[model samples]
Target chain A: EAGVAQSPRYKIIEKRQSVAFWCNPISGHATLYWYQQILGQGPKLLIQFQNNGVVDDSQLPKDRFSAERLKGVDSTLKIQPAKLEDSAVYLCASSLGSRGGSPQPQHFGDGTRLSIL
Target chain B: AQSVAQPEDQVNVAEGNPLTVKCTYSVSGNPYLFWYVQYPNRGLQFLLKYITGDNLVKGSYGFEAEFNKSQTSFHLKKPSALVSDSALYFCAVRDGATGGFKTIFGAGTRPFVKA
Candidate 1:
C-alpha cells in the first residue's frame, strides 16, 4: 500500500507571511494527525482528526495555525502571519485506530520543512 | 498532563554490540507507549508499541522495548546493533484515561552505531 503523502518538501517565508501544507493520508485510515517538529526535538501534536470531525486541537496555536480534514481523506494545515518560531518540520500521519478502540501504529509522510526569515 | 522523556541526547554503540536507549513516561492512566525512528530529512517511522499483555514488545528492524510499570519506563533495545541502525529515536505516550487519543513525544535521542 502507498504511504501517506505530503507536498512541497520545503518552504521558506518571511515573518508575518502565510503558508500552507497539504497531506493525503493512507487509504482507509480513520485517524489523521498533524505534528510540528523543531530541530533536535520530537514531533509535537498540533491537531488530530477522526474521519471528517476534529478530535483534538488543544495544542494548536489558534492565533496562527489552523487545519482542516475535509471528507476525512486529506488534510491541510495553514499558518497565517507566520512567526520565526514557526520554522520547523510539519508532519502528517495516519492510523487505522479510532476513538475507544485499540490503538494502531501510525504511518508517516516525509514532512515539509519550513523556514521563516 | 501526559508526557514522555528521553534522558539521553545521544547514544553511541559499536556494530555487533548491544544497544539501549532509555525512555520514561507520565500519564493519567494505563499508558500506551510507542517508539519511532527518523532518518535525516525524513518522517518518523513507527518501530513498536506497548499497549497491553506483554512487558517485552518486539518491533520492526530487530528492535524491542521493555515496559516497566513500576519505573514507568519503556526502553528500546537492540541485540548486536548494525551501523544501519543509527538514527534519531523518539519515545511517545498516549494517555489511556482520556477518550481523546492525543500523543505526546519526547525530545528524541540520536544513536550512532559505529562499524
Candidate 2:
C-alpha cells in the first residue's frame, strides 16, 4: 500500500505572506493529523481529523492557521500572515482509527519544509 | 494530561556496541507509549509501541524498547548499533482513559553511531 503523501517538499515565503500544504493519507485510514516540527523539537500536533470531521484542533492557531479534510481522504493546512516562528517542517500523518479497542501506529510522510524570510 | 520526556539530548555509540535511549512518561491512567525515528529531511517513522501485554516490544531496524510501569519509563535499546541507525528519536505517550487519543511527544534524542 502507498504511504502517506505530502506535496511541496519545500516552501519559502516572506513574513506576513500566506502558504498552504497538502496531505494525502493512506487509503482506508480513518484518522489523519497535521503536526509542526521545529528544528531540535519533536513534531507537535496541530490538528486531527476522524473521517471528514475534525476531532481536535486545540493547538491550531485559529488566527493564522486553518486546515480542512474534504470528503475524508485528503487534507490541506494553511497559514496566513505567517510569522517567523512558522518556519518549520509541516508533517502529515494518518492512522487506522482512534477507537477504544486498539490504537494504530501513525504513519508519516516526508514533511514540507517551510521557510519564512 | 499526558507527556513524555527524553532525558538525553544525544547519544553516541561505536558500531557493534549496545545502545540505549532513555524516555519517561507521565499520564493519569494506563499509558500507550510509542517510539519514532526521523532521518535527515524526512518525516518521523514509527519504530515501536507498547500498548499492553509485553514489557519488551521489538520494532523495525532491530530496535527494541522496554516498558516499565513502575518507573514510568520506556527506553529504546539495541544489542548492536550500526552507523545507519543514527537518527533523531522521539518518545510519545497517550492516556487511555480520556479516549482523546492525542499523543504527546518528547523533545527528542539524536543518536550517533560511529564506525
True lDDT of residue B24, candidate 2? 98
Which CAPRI level is candidate 2?
high
Instruction: Please state every model's RMSD to the true fold in angstroms.
Output: 1.2, 0.9
Model 1 / residue B81 / CA error / Å: 0.9
Across A18-72, the per-residue lDDT of candidate 2 in tens digits comes to 9999999999998999999999899999999999999999999999999999999
Model 1, B11-98: lDDT tens digits are 9999999999999999989999999999999999999999999999999999999999999999999998999988999999989898
Interface RMSD values for all candidates: 0.7, 0.7
Please state how well chain A of candidate 2 matches the true chain A, as a TM-score.
Answer: 0.97
Over the stretch B1-115, how does candidate 2's per-residue lDDT look in tens digits? 8889999999999999999999999999899999999999888899999999999999999999999999999999999999999899999998988878699999999889999
Write one digit per residue (lDDT tens) for candidate 1, span A35-73: 999998889889999998988899899999999987889
Q: What number of clashing residue pairs does each candidate have, in the order they appear? A: 0, 0
True lDDT of residue B11, candidate 1: 93
Please give the TM-score that candidate 1 achieves against the real structure: 0.97
